[model samples]
Target: MQTLSELGLAVAQRRRALGMTQIDVAKRAGVASDTLSRFELGKATDFGARKLLAVLAVLGMEMQYSLEGHAGSLESLAREHGLRR
Candidate 1:
């Protein structure tokens, strides 16, 4: 499992790669600039899923779970077992 600090670093790297400022992401995600700043600084302890998703969306990314070195689609596997919609 990735630590929150690692995830925050990933988010910051992605945003920087896209030349996006914290205020830009805040505007796009409808969050406060300070909130996004805290997220990027790894100071946020309890990030809400929807807010995190919004932030990822602004950075042109989506959250997913996967096993290490797996090539198969998790969604497909889940559907095969009727595990998720």
Candidate 2:
């Protein structure tokens, strides 16, 4: 995602898809329930990497990275470069 709010929303979606509660995820991730609530609600401004990674781990998820202009998938890149029809 392009921003922290987007990331938080994604986490919330995943949690819901997995039928997980905020308290359960927070306990498993070693964070406060209010913290997770704020995060999922896009109200957290300083949720750190450790807590984020912990939550992702609890949800069987991980973060990915790409340089600014290198975020496209292979299919999109091929299309943009005229290598695909």
Candidate 3:
């Protein structure tokens, strides 16, 4: 999960898990379907953090980070932040 490819895969997986089409998420995030497509393909760098955050929100998701030397499942980190994951 350290590369754009990994990020794209995670996004795709989550999107599928939620039964959401690409167009649905793009509309919800106010981005073009092509942008979302490129994002999910790991082939674009123009998708900024704000757009990414918006898309994640639409997917009922969030970004979580651990300290560089600390490693754990994102669910665990979310729980630490008082989230149900």
- Winning model by TM-score: 2
Residue 85, model 1, lDDT: 58
**Per-candidate TM vs. native?**
0.73, 0.87, 0.77
Sequence-dependent TM-score of model 3: 0.77
Clashing pairs in 2: none
C-alpha local distance difference test of each model: 0.85, 0.94, 0.88
Encode model 2's per-residue lDDT on 1-85: one tens digit a residue: 8788889999999999999999999999999999999998899989999999999999999998889769788998888888974
Clashes of each: 0, 0, 0
lDDT of 3: 0.88
Writing each residue's lDDT as its tens digit, candidate 1 over 21-57 gives: 9899989998888888888788987778888999999
Clashes of 1: 0
Candidate 3, residue 75: CA error in Å?
17
TM-score of 1: 0.73
